[model samples]
Target: MRKIAIAVSLSIFIAFLIATAFLIHPFGYPPSEMDDYIIENTQSETGANNAVTAVVFDYRGFDTLGEATILFTAVTGVVMLFRAKKKREK
Candidate 1:
């Protein structure tokens, strides 16, 4: 009974994932208007020489910060785990 329930749940999850993947846009073909606008305005707006850097650091600053925070948290967690393992060995 439990095994049957687990199998059904796993199948449903796999089907949902496959459906979601199919719904995603094809690679390298993002919405163009925003991309064009960014490319046109990035240097004037942010004074950045490189448009990619301007987008990452200026237009999407908060997103970059969030990613940095996540990376820091992950590194801290790994360090703590290593310390705990070292202590356990003593």
Candidate 2:
């Protein structure tokens, strides 16, 4: 019974993944409106020579900061989990 249930669940998950893969847009297409707007304005608006840097540091500053915070927390949690606990000898 357990094996049957596992097989059914795995089959459903795989089907969903296949359906999603087919729904995605094809590659090498023209940029979306938002992307075009960002590329056009990045240099003049942000005063950055590199558009990628301008987008990361100026346009998406808060979003990038949140990502950094999340990454730092994850690393700290992993480090704490693996750190050796000192034994107190009586």
Candidate 3:
């Protein structure tokens, strides 16, 4: 009985996930109005092959720094949690 209930719940969850994915259009890649001019000027002025990388790293470096700090903190927490504790002498 428990197995049947779990199977039914999992099937319903999977169906809901599939339905949601079909309803949402995840691949919409339309360019925004604000980026058009900046991108063109960046490529022309800076001669950067990838405008997106240039904008992300050069224009918004502070935001990237915050993201890196968050990643570092998470890694530190994981290391601390998994570190071997020294055995106490009797």
Candidate 4:
């Protein structure tokens, strides 16, 4: 019974994957609306001359900030741990 259930689940998942593969857009043709919009409006929207800078610091500002915060926290934790161990050894 358990084997039959697992087989049925796998077959259903395989059918779903095949169906999805057919429904997706063909290879080499990407959806370009977002990229087009960004390129066209980067200067006007953010007045930034660099598109890469605009995307990183403007469009993804909060995400970048969160990453920076996590990185800073990790470094601080490591430094604190090392400093404490050094002090204990002395």
Candidate 5:
């Protein structure tokens, strides 16, 4: 009974995940006017070929810092969860 319930729940969760992935917009709506202005200005001001890359890696480096921090936290959590317990000897 427990196994059957778990299997049903997992199947439902997987189906929901697939439905959401296909139904939802991944990149979301089009960028706003201000976003376009920034891209244009960044290209002209900085003379960078790829405006988006320049903005992400140079103009908005702080956001990248936050993303790195989140990645580090996730890795730490996984390590802690899988770490072996120390044995106590008499």
Candidate 6:
């Protein structure tokens, strides 16, 4: 019964992932209006010479902040784990 339940849950999760994956756009073909708008207005709106910088710092500032936070958290977690392991060994 436990094996059957685990199998059913795994199957359902995989099916859900496949359904969402199919809805995603094909690679390198994202021809959207937002791309044109960003290219045209990046210098004027954000005053950043580089479009990538403009997008990261101006448009997606909060997103970049969140990503930085996550990276810091992961590094801290790894350091803590290593420290604990070293203490145990000693």
Among these predictions, the greatest TM-score belongs to 2
TM-score of each: 0.67, 0.72, 0.53, 0.64, 0.49, 0.65
- The lDDT per prediction is 0.93, 0.85, 0.80, 0.95, 0.82, 0.92
Cα lDDT tens digits for candidate 3, 1-90: 999999999999999999998877566765567687767687776678788887778767798899999999999988776663423322
Residue-wise lDDT of candidate 4 within 1-90, one digit each (tens)?
999999999999999999999989987797999988999999999999999999999988998999999999999999999999999998
Rate residue 65 of model 1 by lDDT. Answer: 100
In model 6, which runs have C-alpha deviations exceeding 4 angstroms?
A: 1-29
Off by over 4 Å in 1: 1-30
Tens digits of lDDT, candidate 2, 56-78: 88888999999999999999988
**Could you arrange the candidates by TM-score from highest to lowest?**
2, 1, 6, 4, 3, 5
Q: Considering summed lDDT, which 10 consecutive residues are worst modelled in model 1?
A: 22-31
lDDT of 6 by residue, 22-69 (tens): 877886777689978999999889888899989888888999999999
Steric clash count of candidate 2: 0
What CA RMSD would candidate 4 show? Answer: 4.8
How many residue-pair clashes does candidate 1 contain? 0
Compose the digit string of candidate 5's lDDT tens values, residues 1-90: 999999999999999999988877666785478778876788677788888888788888999999999999999988776664323221
Relative to the unseen true structure, what is the C-alpha lDDT of residue 55 in candidate 5, on a scale of 0 to 100?
79
Model 6, residue 82: C-alpha shift (Å): 0.4
lDDT of 2 at 25: 75
Clashes of each: 0, 0, 0, 0, 0, 0
Provide C-alpha RMSD values for all models, in order: 3.1, 2.7, 4.4, 4.8, 5.9, 3.4
Clashing residue pairs for model 1: none
Weakest lDDT window of 10 consecutive positions for candidate 5: 81-90
| lDDT (Cα) of model 1 | 0.93
